[model samples]
Target chain A: MLPDATLADYALRLGDDSLVLGQRLSEWCGHAPMLEIDLALSNIALDLIGQASHFLKFAGRAEGRGRDADSFAFRRDALDFRNCLLVEQPNGDFAQTMARQFLFSNWQELLFAQLQHSANDTLADIARKAVKEVAYHAHFANEWMVRLGDGTEESRARTIAGLEWMWRFTGELFERDPALKPLVDAGVAVDVPSLRPDWEDRISRTLAEARLELPKPRRWVMGGRVGHHSEHLGHLLSEMQFLQRAYPGAMW
Target chain B: MNAELPLKDRVLEILSQVADPEIPCVSVVDLGIVRDVRDGKVFITPTYTGCPATAVIEAAIGKALKDAGFALKVATMLSPPWTTDWISDSGREKLRAYGIAPPDRGTAKHSLRDVPVECPRCGSRHTEEISRFGSTPCKSLHRCLDCREPFDRFKCH
Candidate 1:
């Protein structure tokens, strides 16, 4: 049997990725360039948050803890967060946001597609629904990538810069954590490393259509799966967790 | 008449009166939100994983059932995942009448063909998508070229 602790840890990692990314995207809610863009980003953020709730709720159950999704989301310190380094990076500009979305959503869609077949019923169920949502996210981001990469000279430059800023983090998405080996062996979790080839193909094809050169990857960054994160996540958590922290079980 | 029917049928009848919070033209049944009812429980699924209206819909359903004197617990089922194909034909017509383009049947195939959405207002085939994300998560914004009217389409999931 796949250990409950392992399952809880894995679910927390997945949940944290969605939660942190949702928080990052929500920052665009009132700040996007146009009203339509603002709504689009917020809608996506809502979806991510929704997905995060499911994962965290399941994580709590697996851990056999009295804590719920809110506890995992609002109580955990940054060192306990297990999201990848890619999602926590600041959304620099329109181009950077789209680049982050494009890279992350492409990998996420692929991961969820495979995860739908997981032996764990809850994870599989969540993945089945999430794969559909992530498909739309990927499509949305890919459209923007092409538009920005092939648009005005200034837009193309920005798009290139955006990809360059986020490329190093891409490698960590496929990293096979040793702790997850038992789950992978038991078919309770996805073999994340197996998802890389398809991710690369789709990204390469999209980049080609955008007339943008593939970024020359720099030194790959890792450790988010092990709870190591950039400085930005602490600030994000403070803002997101403020309500629950201040009120102590505050409810509307 | 509802009282004369079987318990499940009566419960379903009551639920059919509960309108979707966002799209008032359609009921929970019309949208395929109610999956099944058995063993004093109503199995429901949300149209979108992240739709904020999910809790509202569930609460409303629970209230409607309770008010009708049916003792049942609302349960959410995620397996077999909800799809736009589940929306009833009557639901599609109601959506069209309400000015939102109903999703085209067989979304998987339609999406690949890059099918242009027919405008709910003018029936124009020359509609272009304005934004993939709309005011709601389940919709996409589209503009009719002929009428120049922006409308929402219940996007194919």
Candidate 2:
């Protein structure tokens, strides 16, 4: 079995992924291409934030630390975050945003579905709720990918380019750190690498249906899992954590 | 001794008056979010884990309890996640009457596609989805083919 410390770290990685992506999506509140799309993105952001709270809260408890969800999220520096690089990338355009959602949600769906059966009941319960939400997220993103990819030439070109830009980061999603091995053996966590084949097949079929080809994998950029993040995350934290940082113990 | 209902009963009474922040037509108790009241605690499982109103609902419940002279803590329990199946029959009526279609229980909650959505306004079975995302996270937009009325649907699950 993995030590409590390692399990807490695992939970932080999961929590950070949701929290950082939630912040990124929330930035589209009033700026999405359309009003409905705007609400949809914000709604997705809300869900991610909610999921983040559960994971972070559990992590704190496991660590026997006094930190709560708010402190963990609002106090952590970018160097302390562990989200995959794909999620922290800037939302380039409508197509690019959808591409990022499509890729991440598909991977999340697979992971959460498996996590629902985790040995730990808290993790399982959270996953049971989250898996349903991510399924809709993936469906929404896939539909848009199809519409944009098979639409006009300009849209198709932009959609493909968006996927190409995001593809390099996909490699990091399935990286299995040696620390995760014990958790995987104990059925407390998933083996990240084992999820790759299924994730790849799902992406390939969806891309084909969208009339788009899978972008070739290039040199992989990986580091976010161990707290190394792109520059975008630092700027994102500055905005999201500003309120709590500026006013200590502030509550509504 | 003062004449009043028990603390649990009083808490329930106050909770019954608390409206869902988004759907103002129904009370939180009627929505089946109030799981239980025991030991000076009001346990609730917020509907739609990501709904923006979850916090608002919790705050509203806390204020209602405090105003009623009950020092009860509102605890959130996610073990058995909230479901539309928990919505009372009166809550369903309120939703339909208020122009939003409640989730169809027979369909699996996770199946977001091909599920038949009826129009709340016209009661027509010919409704089509306009967008999976609606005005809120827990809803979807649909239009009735017959009435041509666009309405919000409380997406199943």
Candidate 3:
């Protein structure tokens, strides 16, 4: 069995991805293009946040720390975060938001599908429940990708631009951290690189249905998985952690 | 009659009165949230991972059991994740009577497909979904073309 520290680190990385993305989506609570979209985005945010809580809570327990989901979420500094840069990108426009969701949800769904069989029972259990919720998220994003991509000229142009901007960060989602090699070998973690072909096929099919072209792969990849992040993550954390930092243990 | 029942049956009877905070027409038990009651413990599962009502339902169940003088601990189980198919037949009837279309059983296979929904108000097959999401996480917004009434349909998870 892999050490508890390794398992906690793995859980933290997964939890941070959900936590950061959930925060980004919650930004659309009252600001989405339409009422239906506002509710949909918020619902998706809630689901991601919920998934984050479970993963973070398990991480805390495994690490034998008194900290919990909230602590890991609110107390961590930007340099300590482990989310991919894709999720931390600002929601540029409705099209941009949908593009980001399409890319990330597709990858997340594939990752969880494999993680459900992990030798780690807690991670597997969380993945089993999470896979169901993420399906709807991926479906929602894919539908919008098709609509916006195939819609009016202005919509198609915006959709293309959105995909281009977010496409660079896609590589980081499948990054193979050497620290996790042992866990992968022990069946406690997934071989994330193995998910690429299936993810590519799924993304290609969706883009095709949307009448959009796949953006060329970028030469440089992001390193958010190793505590490196874009400028936006620091700004995001300030807002997300303010209540906790200002008045410790403040509660309603 | 309540006093004559076994402790487990009595505990379940109390639980049946605990309505889902969001869908007030249905109890947690009716929704299959309560998986089991054993040794003074109530094992339940949330309908969705991020459902806000999860904490609320747990609290309600805890209160219900406490009020009945049963010191039962409410524990959440995530394995065998909750499915819409768990909604009891009577629960389905209650949801429809409340003007919310209950989810079709065994629809997980075709979740992304546009399955036809029957209008709870007029029982018409002519219903169109307004949004895949609804006022709550477990439902979708739909409008009956014939009756022109917008209603919530419990979505297949």
Tens digit per residue, CA lDDT, model 2, B1-157: 2338776666777788999999899899878899988876889986666777988999999998888778789998886877777788888889999999988775546557677788998888998887888887778888999999899987777
- Give the per-residue Cα lDDT of candidate 1 at A135: 85
Cα-based lDDT for every prediction: 0.91, 0.87, 0.92
Taking the candidates in order, what DockQ does each have?
0.78, 0.66, 0.86
Candidate 2 structure quality by residue, lDDT tens digits, A104-212:
9999999999999999888888888888889989988988999999899999999998999899899999888887888889999988788999999989988999899
lDDT of 2 at B152: 92
Single-chain TM-score of chain A, each candidate:
0.98, 0.97, 0.98
TM-score for all models, in order of appearance: 0.97, 0.93, 0.97
Query: Over 4 Å off in model 1, which ranges?
Result: A1-3, B108-113
Q: Which residues of candidate 3, in runs, are more than 4 Å off? A: A1-3, B1-6
Docking quality class, candidate 3: high
What tens-digit string does per-residue lDDT give for candidate 3 at B94-124? 9999999998998865767898899999999
TM-score of predicted model 2?
Answer: 0.93
Where is model 3 chain B poorest over a 10-residue stretch in terms of lDDT? B1-10
Against the true structure, whose lDDT is highest? Answer: 3
**lDDT ranking of the models:** 3, 1, 2
**TM-score per model for chain B alone?**
0.94, 0.89, 0.94
What fraction of native interface contacts does model 2 preserve?
A: 0.67
Worst 10 contiguous positions by lDDT, candidate 1 chain A: A1-10
